[model samples]
Target: MRSFFRGVFVIFFLMTASNWASASIGCGDFLRDIASPPDTIEFVGCESEPTKQGAPLTALYRVKGKDALAAELYLDKKMGVTERMKFVCCVWEVRGETFYKDKKTGLGYHIRMGSEETIHNKREEWSKIGYFYITVVHLREPL
Candidate 1:
């Protein structure tokens, strides 16, 4: 019985580890790294309160890279702030690559993509690199 239990424990551990290894950020993981205060970086998404009745809404994400360098991505939407919610953008670093993905859209858009340099100094190198904004639209009913 003891040997059987040990085998079960080992299998459980391997399954958990494998699950973690398979997770990938569709857009990238840059935003994830920035959401935590303790993190060396930070990302925030903001949208203006709807003003005009029919005016298109816009969502903006501000990614503050290390050393205070910052970049912004904007998305236009048709939902109100109450019906739709935006979470802190996430950034992830993997294999020397920096990736940015919208928390809401998951892998739907690639707001920013770069090598190690872009992640370290986004403010200065964003234009030179391929920094772009990703917008995601949801069709959930209003709360």
Candidate 2:
């Protein structure tokens, strides 16, 4: 009787623990990718528009609390081209990572990520260190 009860208890604990663990990882949340700044939090979707100066196409994220654009992206006139992105909020320590690749088209999203320390730390804030553009350029050098 004791052994059976103990096994049942273990199984129940395992089930509950798994649900809690999954919720904490932020895997259910998605990051917003380019035509926007690197500092923008990853979300399920991001919108785009031509900027006021009218050069690079900008990717923008609407931050709920701030009610403003969190990041901006500069895109080429043509599709699937290289980009320059500026981060506006709560992102520091950026690095480029190749998240996807295509065998046929040879196009992929080379993305920037914040360091673990910075990513987890600055959740609800804005960017601007020394009042300069926190920009990342995604371009491959000449082959």
Off by over 4 Å in 2: 1-91, 102-104, 113-121, 126-142
User: What would you estimate as the lDDT of candidate 1?
Assistant: 0.26
Candidate topping TM-score: 2
**Model 2 Cα lDDT, one tens digit per residue, 14-113:** 2222122111111111223323324433343322222322111112122222221233222232123233322323333222322233333342322332
Tell me the lDDT of model 1 at 35: 37
- The regions of model 1 sitting more than 4 angstroms off are 1-30, 33-38, 48-106, 113-143
- The global C-alpha lDDT for each of the candidates, from Candidate 1 onward, is 0.26, 0.26
For model 1, the run of ten residues with the poorest summed lDDT: 78-87
On residues 31-118, what C-alpha lDDT tens digit does candidate 1 reach at each position? 3432322233233353332332211122223233332223221111211111111111222221111123335444221222112223
Question: What's the count of clashing pairs in each model shown?
Answer: 9, 9
